[model samples]
Target: MLGTIIITIFILGPVGVLSQSAENNSISERIIGGHSAAEGQFPYQVSIRVNGKHECGGSIISSFWILTAAHCVARYPLGVLLVVVGTNHVKLGTPYGVAQVFVHEQYESQTKINDIGLIKLAGRINFNAKIKPIQLSTSLQPPGTSCVLSGWGFTNVQTQTIPDSLQYIGMRIVSVERCRAAISAAGLNMPVVDTQVCAFNAPGRGACNADSGGPLVCNGVQYGIVSWGNPCATGVPDVFTSVAANRKWIAIKSGV
Candidate 1:
């Protein structure tokens, strides 16, 4: 658990927004590429949609709660915050539950800081192999440990349409010094806030706009939430609001 916690903290930290890139530009290519974020068995591997339209991905942290990006909440109205669970293929199936989306009181879409949100479901989910909450990490990520990221974002950055299957890739945590160097080079003042950590693609794969609000899951634990990217997993560094840094805040806010 300690090893995993260290790994996750290292892999996620700092700014991201909508993206268009060479990695994945279209939904068809991503689906054909064989990577998607909705696969696997976990009570919380969830999906959210607004107004009957799929908006982005997320995870269920509690039987009656779902967690995801703050930007996602800002992008959509409170109309229908659909929380889908289990069954990877989102196209065909019954969802575990439906919920109302609520953004963190301090969540600011413009700043992309404290980018956290929750969904209160109308009913509780029955835990099962295919449906279970992912383990959350309270341990901070140590630089360089590898962690895994999964999502249904475009195969690359420029593509449209979300992939039908889930995609996953492994990455290493970026040291604070390095993550800061990357951010500084971009001309933005490095965040002084201590509760954040950073990560990027090990070499090839990366995250994009479609991947925002996703989980930076590692070591069987969810250590960070996808918040922002400067270059959208490209040249500019990406950032995540470190979970270990805000575990107590989340628990208290969500009443977990």
Candidate 2:
């Protein structure tokens, strides 16, 4: 039916991450609305600093495990990576501990598919007010629902990374059919794989590299994992790893 929508809507850029917050109220609103999370909800979400160098974000699904995109993992080797939890401050603070990291055996860069990996921490994460795990929904998220995403990534495109304070924005879920049509319209085939989901109405919101593997909390539940977004925050819809689709694999690995 609407298989050609994806091609036509290649990409229109999105606005900056509300860079207009100069007043105390606007700044406070940004803090509360964007990056603020209730204590211990998404505890597994942490800033992954490699060799104490670059900071790539990740999510902890288990006491000893973290899930993140393969692209982020491949940027460096395992031993050089260190996991830092409870990081709201960007440049200062201790980021937990890193024991070992394991990449998905099937991840391939050229395909930009199967982009998932896990990190095994040296020690069980200390459960605390700022450290909590988000619940992964085992079912596909209902379309048209409001979606919440957060990250330390930049507010602008030219920037390559996110700031210290985690920032976030709320968006709506795009229907599967609409998402497929969008891709098809772009001269790409409709995405029918169980691994992906498309969210809707992100006029000025999306992932900018630092948000990989973080939760897409919808309706008070974790629905999706950030995967990819080109020209992020624009017309190109952000793609995610459908939590429902990988339940079996996660269950096998995480026993959840």
RMSD, candidate 2, Å? 8.6
Clashes of each: 38, 18
TM-score of 2: 0.77
User: Whose TM-score is greatest here?
Assistant: 1
Superpose all Cα atoms of candidate 1 onto the true structure and report the RMSD in Å to 1 decimal. Answer: 7.2
Over 1-256, each residue of candidate 1 has an lDDT whose tens digit, in order, gives 0000111111222222213222321111011122444445434566666665555667778888777766666655555556667766646434644546667777654555677777778888887777778777889878776776666555543444466666666656776667667655555543624565566553334554445566777778887776655423444345666777767877876776
lDDT of each candidate versus the true structure = 0.56, 0.54
TM-score of each: 0.78, 0.77
Put down candidate 2 lDDT per residue, 1-256, tens digits, no spaces: 0000011111111222222211111000011124544534455567667667534566767777777666567666667777777756656544556666556666655443565666777788876777777676788766777877765554554444445566666766776666655544433332425576665444445555456655667876777666554344544455666777766766776566
- Candidate 2 worst ten-residue window by lDDT: 22-31
